[model samples]
Target: MRLLRLPEVMYLTALSRSNLYRKIQAGTFPAAARTGSNSVAWVEEEVLAWIQARIDERGLPDTP
Candidate 1:
């Protein structure tokens, strides 16, 4: 399973770090699993699925 850092995930999803945190708090997106006290990462599949849901709902074209 692939994992992604916040910055990489943010770049991939086009969401600011704050917005990602807010979405996680709101239970709209999967939360990152803590790998260390100062490190966290998300399951790539979960993040991609969340992005896909946004695309499906907003009719946003897939990022090239």
Candidate 2:
């Protein structure tokens, strides 16, 4: 149930700040939880699952 800060999320996802926000806006990425008025963090498990999903997608075979 750990929450990851923006920097940590960026590092783990290898996404720039702008791109991350863009994905979030597009509903393609996990949403962050508001920790404070000026602070937000993502759930660690959600981020990890997103990464794993990407990996799984990449490992799938292409179909005609």
Candidate 3:
């Protein structure tokens, strides 16, 4: 039930911020939960799941 901030998401997904935002806009990724007026975070499990899906689709190696 952990939550990840932007840097965690970027590191975990190997995505640039703009790419991440693009995927969000395309409905291809999970939206972050709003934590405050200027804060948001993604569920860790969901981020992991999304990474898994990408790996599965691209036949990429697992993250260490």
Candidate 4:
């Protein structure tokens, strides 16, 4: 149950800060957990699952 900071998440997901926040707001990405008064982190497993889901979606056939 590791928590990943913003930099780590950006590196792993290849997303910029704004884009990440946008996805979060859109509910397409996992929300961050508040770690402190001015700190927040994401659950490692949840981020990984989101990535895996994207991969799975890519592998699915497009329906007309």
Model 4 agreement with the true structure over 1-64: per-residue lDDT tens digits: 9999999999999999999999999999999999999999999999999998988878787668
- Which whole-number lDDT from 0 to 100 does residue 60 have in model 1? 67
Q: Provide the global lDDT of candidate 3 against the true structure.
A: 0.94
Clashes of each: 0, 0, 0, 0
Better of 1 and 3 by TM-score: 3
In TM-score terms, which candidate is top? 4
How would you order the candidates by TM-score, starting with the best?
Answer: 4, 2, 3, 1
The segments of candidate 1 whose C-alpha lies over 4 angstroms from its true place after superposition are 59-64
How would you encode candidate 2's per-residue C-alpha lDDT over 1-64 as one tens digit per residue? 8999999999999999999999999999999999999999999999999998988888787568
Which sections of candidate 3 miss by over 4 Å?
59-64
**Each model's Cα RMSD:** 3.2, 4.2, 3.1, 4.4
Residues 1-64, candidate 3: write the lDDT tens digits. Answer: 8999999999999999999999999999999999999999999999999988877998767789
Q: Whole-model Cα lDDT per candidate?
A: 0.93, 0.95, 0.94, 0.97
Please report the candidate that would top lDDT against the real structure: 4
RMSD of 1: 3.2
**Alpha-carbon runs more than 4 Å astray in model 2:** 60-64
| Cα lDDT tens digits for candidate 1, 1-64 | 9999999999998999999999999999899999999999999999999988887998767788
TM per prediction: 0.85, 0.90, 0.87, 0.91
